[model samples]
Target: MISPRVNTRVWQRSISLLSPQAAKTESNVVTKERTYIENLSKDIATSRFRLVDENGKIASITVQPDIPICIKKDCLVSIHNLNHLSLSYKWLNFWSNLIKFRSFKSSLFHRIIGSSVLEILAAPNFQTSRRPFDSSRSLSVLNLTGTKDWNVFGKDSIIAFEQNSSLEIKSPIFPSARSLVSNSSKSQLPRKFQILNGRGNVLVCGGGLVYSIELIDESDKILVNSRNILAINGQ
Candidate 1:
């Protein structure tokens, strides 16, 4: 059996906005908000986390971490199941090294790099919103209008982000005004792109090179060989 990672407490002092608020779940959530949700095929090997839909048909979900659930119905695959190196989020970088010691406590395998290996950060960005995201399951909320998505916020996922993986702050440019498109299509991924807000853009963070994002807007260009890109906030 694969040896599981150890339990590490995630620090939340950086984001005080989430203190008075809580993560949401499946219920009557997503009222007047543009919500996103991607179905799952199997449970991913996440250490421990929750899911919350800001724009959902439901208000809140109830499942917690460490409690495995058996599939009772036919499963469907997602973009995350395809194992495409093209759609990868590079989180390891120079700046991350600065805070590596700060995150040592919340991680499992901190310094191992391999094709089959996945590294979990000791500190995942916190997603804070007006109503507060409901992290009942594996859903995460990144409030863009708020300080959440504007800067680094929300826990980074080991898997690709979807509606089931994370939430993004609606930009003043579109979406919230119903004028933009949701970047969940697989064809949008570049030869090298990082997972961010379930969308694909030419990631330039961590001092990487700029490259084409492929099959979409030219600005969607992502940087090559960089995974520190947690999400793409711009178009």
Candidate 2:
């Protein structure tokens, strides 16, 4: 997705240099070189772009119109055409305590301002960073075309997703039996499982180093510990 376009002039010059007899005379080569430089300047002026890297993790994307992208909170290094983009919190689970906490803060902020709703944007000089431990966790960038509908994920696994994608709490099975079997050593166990459902580009933060395995069939199913699941790709 981030491959740079090749410059044809480089190849042309190399071919000319390699030929014993002049493929292009010195005067012709100089003319072509000047023309190439002029064209390169035009391309840069009309289609300029930049790569943003923070904490040595590079997010290379060309700023374009109407392309929806999801970036994790505190991960953005820089952006262009700020006026053309919109930002909002992508609700993952309304029932989760994290959402509840955020809602409470938002409400209090709005009440102080005497507004029904409040939206905030970063100031031009504002800055943020991921903790060292957090940065150690791998980030996975996925390109989805809306073909797969079902995705099961563990709690806190999703870092960010496009606005159009929908995520809801999913309980794959009743946890009563699971609790009895898995929680014998502990006093209690969580009685539910949470999953995200959507189709779009998503960034998932794994607990640690993350690896993926393909599920060939029902018989090949591998039970991943809940904490280790970063994202599920298909139905």
Clashes of each: 37, 0
- Worst lDDT run of 10 residues, candidate 2, spans 106-115
Residue-level lDDT tens digits of model 1 in 1-235: 3234522222211211121024232223232122322212133332222222232211121222322211101111111222322222223322332243344221121221223322221112122222222322222333222212322222222222222233331212111221233466222321122223432111111112211122233333323332333334444
All models, RMSD in angstroms: 20.1, 17.4
**Candidate 1, poorest ten consecutive residues by summed lDDT:** 70-79
Each prediction's whole-model lDDT (CA): 0.24, 0.37
> lDDT per residue, candidate 2, 1-235, as tens digits?
3235855433333222211122234445445634564565454321111212322123343322333444444444455444534555433344453343333211111001111222222111113443442355444444433344434344434444434424233444433443212324432223334444443344444444455454433333334565555455453
Would you estimate the TM-scores of all the predictions? 0.21, 0.44
User: Which one wins on lDDT?
Assistant: 2
